[model samples]
Target chain A: MLEVRDLHAYYGKSHILQGVDLDVGEGEIVSLLGRNGVGRSTTLKAIIGEVPPEGSISFKGEEIAGRKSHVIARKGLGYVPENRDIFPTLTLRQNLILGQKSARAQGRWSIEDAFELFPNLRERADISAGVLSGGEQQMLTICRTMMGDPDLVMIDEPTEGLAPQIVERVGRLIEEIAARGVAILLVEQKLTIALHISARIYVMGHGRITFEGTPEDLRGNEQIRKEWLEV
Target chain B: MEVFVFSLFNGVLYGMLLFLLASGLTLIFSMMGVLNFAHASFFMLGAYFAYQISQPLGFWPALIAAPILVGVLGAAVERYALRPVHRFGHVAELLFTFGLAFVIEEVVQMIWGKVPVPYDVPPSLNVTAFAWQGLDYSVYRLFMLLISVGIFVALFFGLTRTRIGLIIRASLTHPHMVASLGHDVPKVFMWTFGVGCALAGVAGVIGGNVLGTEPGMAIQLGPIVFVVIVVGGLGSLGGALIASLLIGVLNNMAISYDFSLYPIFSLLGVEREAEGILADLVSLTTGAIAPLVPYLLLVLMLILRPRGLFGTRDV
Candidate 1:
């Protein structure tokens, strides 16, 4: 479980996140829905301590605000950065090893399990990550995080730039992860993707949360949806 | 043929020594992304500490103790000095190391005096170990070769075999990602910096006898070490090894064929006297163009291949 209470974050002088708040219960997939540059990514970054937020970020009831990004990651928080920043020079196997060995996460998805989840990864495990296609890279990034076996995983733009088929696969994968009893904070631009996988949704606009509800409750809520999601 | 064989033998030995210094620089620079100007200064301190301690504890103990002391000192510098400057940016970190070099050189002169300290090779290694092509190879030169090779082997093994080595290799390419995986990155960095300095200190112990122990040793060897790193590529140990051997062999070959190269200068109608500072300088730039050759190679490498021989990222 994770609780981000009235979190504020800035990039230099720009106050990118202003008094934002959200919560995700255990084994639940929560979606933070927002249009471009509305601070959805920043909120995820803040929770992971990459953005150095001011305010309370209690993950599994431990205060983690302003800690080093790596420190927060070690505290059972898995972050899939917006770009899926894979170590390009390393082999997929080596990258996965780094993930598995370093993070304080142990779970059902071992390296072998991860390889089974993404068969393409197993086939290309020995090759450099740089040479992989965009879809394969995304899969590796997601699987690499899963290899760490975190209790909660934050996926930033998992479907961004992905093909429709891969996007669908990622949606299914997210659902599978939630089913495995792990919480997820899905920051997504694609409403359909978020709606398909997430149990709860929050709409964000101008660095503030405007709506929070279940998929059906938010389905026809046109006013807040149009203001935040339509664009 | 006999003189050539001797030169070749000496060349390999000297090259291995250069490799020791360059390897440390390459590791620290490539991994940390900071060209530690104080690296050679640490080398200088190693010589001074050896000279001071050798007076009381004898040469063998000084050789063993000096590098360990330097490693501890290096760890201290990383924790207290480099870590703070790292927050400011790369340029500030560079300038900080540059200042550190100056302070170290000044400190050496203040403590050891302006003159070169008489740090002799141990009597145990004073005699000739072998006669190669009728040239007597001193036991000290053989010792230097053994120590250099030993360090290289140990370093290579330590990097490839140990868990810490694996972490360091991963961090070298993806420092942030490594930290994200939950290892204490700063601690790894501190240890790396310490190891790098320790290697430099070991080089100083051996190199002091080869080139004389002095306050001037740091400045004398500093720029060439830079050349070694630039030519070797930013962070690749393989590249560093190749570059070090290349520079070392080239320097020796240059000495033997100095007059042959001079004729080419005459063919261009460009005499050394016309070339301003090149005609008149004693600071490793003029009379023995051997030392300057590595830097020239480095500049050319930068122009043609900035990523270095095997670097994955920009230099």
Candidate 2:
């Protein structure tokens, strides 16, 4: 549903993303894997119009490169930043309400559905989001993006700082979201989960995709992982 | 006792008016994180608009129309003037607003002249509302009190009980998150500035006659409102109310009481009307300098409660 070709982005004078090319089809889970500071996050940001992409970004056949972030969001492109940007001062309920395109617009996800998926959110729906645990905040950031009901979601590091159990839950949640016909572009640090879940994996190094293959193909090629991914 | 009561009532009336002005300042500052140095200029615009509108349509219509006109002007300024300078960082934006205030004052003087415009209270509400303690309070004062109270109530309800208000409150904290949710955030900021200036405009409509509408009107009221915001806390509406009322009452009391430090000296048998720096310091007590009270509160709040009474961020 999304097509990106020869994407390049910059931070001031420094080139952060250099000629990156990738795509994700309908309901397909694609993983972008790399070591820290390899432009994986910048690739997603460039696609989502945060970094001002230099090349081409066609999302469902629309030229969206250099568009404003909100305009991209309106075009059914949801972005969850790596930092887990939650409104700390706002209550969890208000945050969710803010996530929707319109309060009255009917979508597949409801507030009740979110509450059911994570009972912790339901219990503290009325309190400030700042007080939530890191894992709960991660859940909130993911679920909050789902409230927008984007056709394609670019999530950056969803499992960062999360416990193993919570990380498993995040993996399941991604699977559930993909099953519901939503395409996901996941930027993950952990290799095992990305390999297990992603239909296709793109190993990034030095601002470009060094390797792109199926999970089995990636497993067979240890040279690519040792050079681009392993610490 | 009667003097004390006089200051008390007048303080309340003035305090409410200050709240009317400061609440808008609070909203704009808290949401946009821009100080909006031009806020009081909007208040001045409201008064001038009321003066111009009331000339043809009369006082009541001007009261309603002036604020709306000023609000639109505020929105346009946000879109054109303020938004353009945002790229240069907050200091440039602040300087832009500061320069805008100067331009507004100069334009106001050119249009209305350097002299104060004859923006008087309506003839119908000129009569006395009530008399107590040998004082006859004008009905206009009561109207001002009632109108300010109404604004406070409406603003409170609108912000707390509506979806738009919820969005505004959320925007105050997480602007990017709201935008990611598909809101045109710049539009939200423009409207926020508009709403804030509208509230100030409304304050100017009622406060014009009492405070006087002149070129220096903004200069006089602007710093006080900033003081109100700072002392209240940078982002807390509740804190603004408390600070406004507190500043208002202290200002009046300070003006009314000629309670010099001479009393302590006299108690110590140091004598009256003595010469030198010690006597000069003692002679100059809380009298006729109401402006000092806000600055005092500001300093104390800065030193004691830097985050303000309810502010989460230290500004």
iRMSD in angstroms, per model: 2.5, 1.6
Residues B245-306 of candidate 2 have per-residue lDDT tens digits of 88888999988986676777788777676778667766777874466888988988899988
Model 1 C-alpha RMSD to native: 3.1
- Computed on C-alphas against the true complex, the DockQ of each candidate is 0.44, 0.64
Put down candidate 2 lDDT per residue, A11-77, tens digits, no spaces. Answer: 9999988899998998899999999998998998887776778999999999899988889999999
Tell me the spans in candidate 2 whose CA falls farther than 4 Å from its real position.
Answer: B1-5, B263-273
lDDT of 1 at B302: 90
Candidate that would win on TM-score: 2
lDDT of 1 at B300: 89
Q: Which is the leading candidate under DockQ?
A: 2
